[model samples]
Target: MAFQCQRDCYMKEFVTTVVSCCPAELKHEVNGKKETLKGFNVKLQDTILFPEGGGQPDDHGLIADVPVIRVTRQGPEAIHFVASPLAVGQEVQVKVNWERRFDHMQQHSGQHLLTALADTMFGFKTTSWDLGRQRSVIELDTPCMKPAQLQGLEEAVNEKIRAHVPVTVQLLSIDDPAVEKVRSRGLPEDHAGPIRIIDIEGIDANMCCGTHVSNLSHLQVIKLLGIEKGKKNKTNLIFLAGNRVLKYAEKSYSTERAMVSILKTGPDEHVEAVDKLQKSVKLLQKTNLSLLRDMAVLIAKNFENNPQKGNFFSLHKKEGDNEFMNIIANEINTEETLVFLTVGEDKGPGLFLLAGPSRSVAEMGPWVLKMLKGKGAGKNGRFQGKANSLAQRAEVEVFLQQHCKHQTSEEE
Candidate 1:
């Protein structure tokens, strides 16, 4: 009889304890299934892994040396999936990443603080919450709030954080008499089974399903991002907590440092420096326009001296936009002459403008616009079009000259 290896049999029985330890090692089997460790099983002995529920992300860390790849809620229990397999009934030390856990705790507690403050100060109740990686948002029942009112509420929450109030977590059954003391404006009495209530001594007491820190001091700092009007009768508040606040501060400092270097000013003068740069830009733009106008005057004088005899005089120059060409056309239009000015590259894109003191140019304006494949309207003997190329400008000029002559002949 050939001896057979029990690898397949052993693989089926692999298990890791879930809730017996503080940081339980979760054994998982990988066979090309769900990514990010989802759908994996856990052997929790009354697990405390906060599942992804109640607008809070599941706690993440290593379990029994293997990474607790993902924690998700299925029904009631928080299931933790791990990477490597473990022996059934094997005792392994568990380790939870306290930093990640603590950050979540701060955010969760900060939310409670804010919600409690909202209810007490402004008669508003938090309806929902979204805990993001960088920011946390709480949606309130009231849709609108003045900036001054939001500022006051933020100041009040920060004061509580500074006070270092203890946050006590109590687990109670639905029938427990103490459950009556747990008052939340949003939660219904018959909503669920056993409920967990978080109490901030003398400040707040509310029913919550998320994990929180032991005290308000753990939150360290709470920064309000803003409050915006949301869907009917709901106001959304964005905030930052714990290390997120520090991270924001670090990023802001980096931005200020870069701005200081670019603006060539000290930290104190950064605002003033930016203001000065804006004013300088405006003055430079005005000076440039004045110079363009002077150049247009010069070009018109030269055109007058070397007049192109005909009903239409055409000129094309390398210019920025229609502004310069329009200026030159207006200067020449003062005389009883019709001018078709097209300014830009002959091989590339350009602008077209026709200003003349004749009804022929005005009548032929629509035809020229169509020939150039550009858009504009003419009224009171002035027309303009955005030309695709300087070649199109020449085409338009020829079309205008022929049309004007034809119309003059017809009138005669």
Candidate 2:
């Protein structure tokens, strides 16, 4: 038996009696996070909310003033998932979200028309299709389509829309001979009663169980957006239909306006403006690197002039990076001198490097890493890695000074 939703796709509201209501929970795992939806699985004598199936999402609505989160099909029954329970024998009014339902109808019917024309005109069979939140996709059996072919296909779909072709639903018995003549992908295992076929006037007839508009004119227009490479050597054609096309246009215009204001350029010059800005940024970055290298040489020279004051030198620069520290170390002669360099906030996490005597560096590198909550390795008297905390930097400098002093005393 066809559910009331299938019987009248246009119906937005209906009065019905609740057959059963039981507690249920739906869980979804997303990015390792578990989200559980607590609700009641409600079975109604008949409903206006279409259950999810046939590549179409379920309709969200209200039953007895309670919000319906989802609807699913079980055999011939449509189960409504609601946040609140309803009395079994109570007569309640069910309301469907008409705006969402109508939008889906437009896109679903548009897919049927596009699929039929592609198969007939270009011999492209639709392997599958998806009705997304903002746009829909139809994956064809072919690997790709030429630009001209795509343009022609889109034009043909809109032409049929302009022709105002009527879309009708037909039900056929499982054993009917005429059923063999129509297109189908086999009935569901739990499918019962007559098979439902969506016939697009004289264009084509295919088995489907989703809600659709009564006429192609209801589609308003179909815009083929673009194509993406699909898995299994298929070509996925992306498209927007009905109000979605208008929504896309509005969003695009708004973005253009914002860019024009920011770039101080007309819509036509946005690409050139962005390209010039990117080039300017790259040049600035290159010049900054050269200046940093020159500054590193100067810093090492100043330290060499006063090497007798302290063999251990410590410096921290917020703007200096790991490469900058390496440049300074290379310029400084460190046969007897040990230098500790850090780049980042004075008391927060950053980077640290130690370069000096081979034995001292090797022994102190792991100690520095542990004290700063970091990890690093030393080779040829240079140890550096990321530090999670620089709060103990002053204490680390004092310890290094004592070690150098102890070494000097032993040498005497």
Candidate 3:
């Protein structure tokens, strides 16, 4: 038997079937395919299941010692799929996982309470609802609500929960003339079957397909997590209820405690402690730069006194950092003499070399690099590149002797 609801609401009916019994083992074949079993192709008249529809997840539990893997709606009936296929004419005692079911119910009911509150207190209507794992969100017709106003709405919802108002479900034929009396935003009015309407005592009444609790008290608590702007003057709000609210509270407390311990300060001073640490880092950077300048000056003085007696002179040294190396290179390049300065870590040869003006050093730069199995190019009497080995210093000196002679003979 089917009847349409005047209000366009949906009510879930609990029905029990009585039939002759046989032992049926629930079989789960859908899990192998990693797909949610939509319908169980079984012959049984002894089970009642909540099917997957209306944004509600499937119900799972044991039916006569066989695991009911999933429940889904096929046509107009709810079918229960088990872990093992059930034989024809088998009797099974069906049980639903009350914990999961109740959690879903709380979330659904909380959504209605919040939506109704938004309509009554602020003239904001709920356009849609999405019941998700861990949290649920509702979209309102208004674009934004002040934080203080949302907090008030949360307080008002929890007050209704504390009052423990009864929730009533009513079924009405869709073709009934009274259907126009109950106003709603999202439900389609011309549907075929009876519509279910859930009423929260004096608080709210709405059209919804999801399962819900019998009273507001089952929600235990209602917390508004946050609100954000949605498309076209709409607002999305996230919320938590019952056990979810408790879990969030516990997690927040643990985070604050850890922060206090790390900062070695009370809750109020943690932010200030982080600010002080940032300032200390900035001061240390300035001190390091000043020390680098002093070290570069001392290295340049040493290079002036110990010039090599040749047209080409190259000095390789371990410097404090790359910035100090560039500073020393700039100082050496100012003089008219020919010199090459290479700086690197002490573990191996330098990766960067800078050459000053001298014909023999400029010519030997590429030839000596080629002898060391490295490649480089230069113009305007300066060259720089990587050296393959620290031992290549001897090869560099010998190459300078050979190349400087050719330059000296040309000058003569």
lDDT of 3 by residue, 1-412 (tens): 1211112113222233423222344434554554443333442453444556556676666656666666655454445655455545554556667667777778888988998888899998888778787888899998789988898999999999999899887667766665566545544333345666677888776655557778888889998999887889999999998888998899988988998989889988978998998898888877877787777776666665666544444556665455665566666643444555556644465654545555544655676677545555666655666656556665565565566566657768
lDDT, candidate 2, 305-328, per-residue tens: 873746778888887788899988
- How well does candidate 3 match the true structure, expressed as C-alpha RMSD? 10.5
Worst 10 residues of 1 by lDDT: 1-10
Which candidate has the highest TM-score of all?
Answer: 2
Q: After superposition, how far is residue 345 of candidate 1 from its true place, in Å?
A: 18
Candidates ranked by TM-score? 2, 3, 1
Measured on C-alpha atoms, candidate 2 has an lDDT of 0.90
CA RMSD of all predictions: 10.9, 2.9, 10.5
* Model 1 C-alpha RMSD to native: 10.9
- Supply the TM-score for candidate 3: 0.60
If both were scored by lDDT, which would come out higher, candidate 2 or candidate 3? Answer: 2
Better of 2 and 3 by TM-score: 2
**Candidate 2 Cα errors over 4 Å, as ranges:** 29-32, 333-338, 342-352, 357-380, 386-412
- Compared with the true structure, the alpha-carbon lDDT of candidate 3 equals 0.66
Model 2 alpha-carbon miss at residue 295, Å: 2.5
Q: Give me the runs in candidate 1 sitting further than 4 Å from their true place.
A: 1-39, 185-193, 276-412
Give the alpha-carbon lDDT of every model: 0.71, 0.90, 0.66
